[model samples]
Target: MQQPPSHAREILRLAVPAFGALIAEPLFLLADSAIVGHLGVAQLAGVGLASAVLHTAVGLMVFLAYSTTPAVARAMGHGQLGKALAAGRDGVWLALLLGIVLAVAGFWAAEPLVALMGAEGDVRSFAVDYLRWSMPGLVAMLLIFAGTGVLRGLQDTRTPLLVATAGFALNVVPNLWLVYGLGWSVAGSAAGTSVAQWAMASVYLVMVQRNAARHGISLWPDWSGIRAMTRVGSWLMLRTLSLRIAILATVFVVTGQGAVNLAAHQLAMTIFSFLAFALDALAIAAQALIGKELGASNSVRARQLTGTMIRWGAGFGVVTGTLLAVAAPWAGALFTSDAGVQSVLTYALWILAAGQPIAGYVFVLDGVLIGAGDAKYLALAGVANLAAYVPMLVAVA
Candidate 1:
């Protein structure tokens, strides 16, 4: 019997690197906000509005990673490495196809979408610019999602950590140079991030290709496999869609409060995302490990892993929440200099911090169920959650 300490080590082995990789995703936005913040309130407010739409789009597609991870992990656990690779390949193909469609639509509809969010004046103009420029990266982002899913399925979080770190560096320098050095404004920020995303996608594609070649898996799209992937992903997508709708609703409400409030909300949301991703690292670990365990028919071990991870998630939340609370007063200064935005953000951070424990628990359980391939229930529950949440949100609005 593996001791409890062994379980902790296993979770940490994946979770630690997963933490770094996960946080880097949000760091992209964090960096964007920090750099764009210094431009001016209108600029900052514009990017904020654009990012809400962008994040919602990306969030809805997260099932690419969510679905592929468990399928690949399960197949690998069952000793079907080739099949696992095949699943990953299908995911990439699906990502590419979906990316193209979304990019085209998003590019053409950027103005309408931003307008729909109630943005106006320079904020609307900047948002439209940012959204249109960001279209190119949509495909790359989805590819990265699928590729990261493949690697996670293969129990290779380290590669993602390395790639994401490099990608972050790649994103920041160009953004700084382009936005400041060349005066590209929000467009430059979007362009730089897009380029970095593509670079990251390329690396993932190469790695996936190499693995498929090594395992003698065909790189060609298998329609049946892709169909199957889509079927599973549909449920997960619904679940994700619900979550995105919630966030988007929140953003819409904030946007109506004026640019200053919207800008503050954006910074606060960005920071919240950073912390959420940090906490989700444990969930990522659970997804990988639990899927493998269940695939191997090791229910007992899966249960044990779940218990350990939940505790870790809660504890990690407590620690992070405390730190966030302590830093709340000054954290806004790191992203923006506007005193009004900073003050609003400080209050938001405190509220966010207080909810950390509950969020941590929910995130972990969500991952556990996802890893177990309980998408149908998750989807239904997600709808239920949204139903329950909308009223509260409306009340606040």
Candidate 2:
């Protein structure tokens, strides 16, 4: 009999492409920041503030992906392709419903949300504009999340990488033309990103539809399946919400400091997000692989995979942290020309760099547990984490 591939090999198979796809998601923000940063400090700060709100909203819905991935993977492991496709379809439908509601709410609440973030004057105006214009893309983003989850559960990360890369490339030109050429300012950047997001979502929908048809799965939304998804997702959402709250609180504090500090925080946060996603590739692998292993009732393989991934996560973190630390001073210049913002950003980047190893270890274990369908424990852990973090945040404030 032929021997199976090594655990590391299996992880890299998924992780390499996952890394590309994962980073591409954040590249959307990075691209926006790079493009919008040149407009002026106020513009960058405004986008930064708006993004925190946008990210918080979308982050809450991440269970669409997280819940779907393992559910589908488990079904597949049980040799139920139709059931897996059915589960994925429900995730897509749920995404659509939530996306529409969120888009409307986001559009209407744009100003209030920006104000709540402590934005004012030109920053407030710019933030509201970006937030409202970006609403359409919010729907697309959730769809992408669901669709990407479907593919990941099916053990195919390459397609997402392709779609995301194309979307990123598609995003740049329009943003440039709209912001500089048409002089639409922050609104233009938001519009361009929204357009690209829709395009990517379209591709994912087409693929999902094709798969469903091939598997003889109905395209209609199964309310029952969606309910099941949400049931599992609630715990995951709570887990995710805790993390978002931490991030939002950080932004809230920084926003109070002044435009320069807020702008610097945004740049540092964007870089931090970029690195976080890069590290999360291994986590993504863990989710898919561990879920499948557990579904197949192979706890031994699951545990082995978990150990290997943890090591990889830590090692990858060290390398990324070192690079980030080395790049801290110069990295700020890439986003903005403002000397004050650049100086503050350098300090933030150094701090972020120092935390990467811990972040990496946490991310992988989170994925491992998530893959195991241990959502309740994760949710409880999230609360504890938030409780611990809040005091530190208060001290900083």
RMSDs, each prediction?
A: 1.2, 1.8
Per-model TM-score versus the true fold = 0.98, 0.98
Q: Report the C-alpha lDDT of model 2 over 254-341, residue by residue, as the tens digit.
A: 9889999999999888898899999999889989999999889999889888988898789889999999999999998899999999
lDDT of each: 0.93, 0.92
Q: For candidate 1, give the lDDT of residue 261.
A: 95
Poorest 10 consecutive residues by lDDT, candidate 1: 1-10
Candidate 1 residue-wise lDDT, 250-337, digit = tens = 9899988988899999898899999999999999998999999989999999999998888878888899899999999999889888
lDDT of candidate model 1 versus the reference = 0.93
User: What shift in Å separates residue 319 of candidate 2 from its native position after superposition?
Assistant: 0.3
Which pairs of residues collide in model 2? none
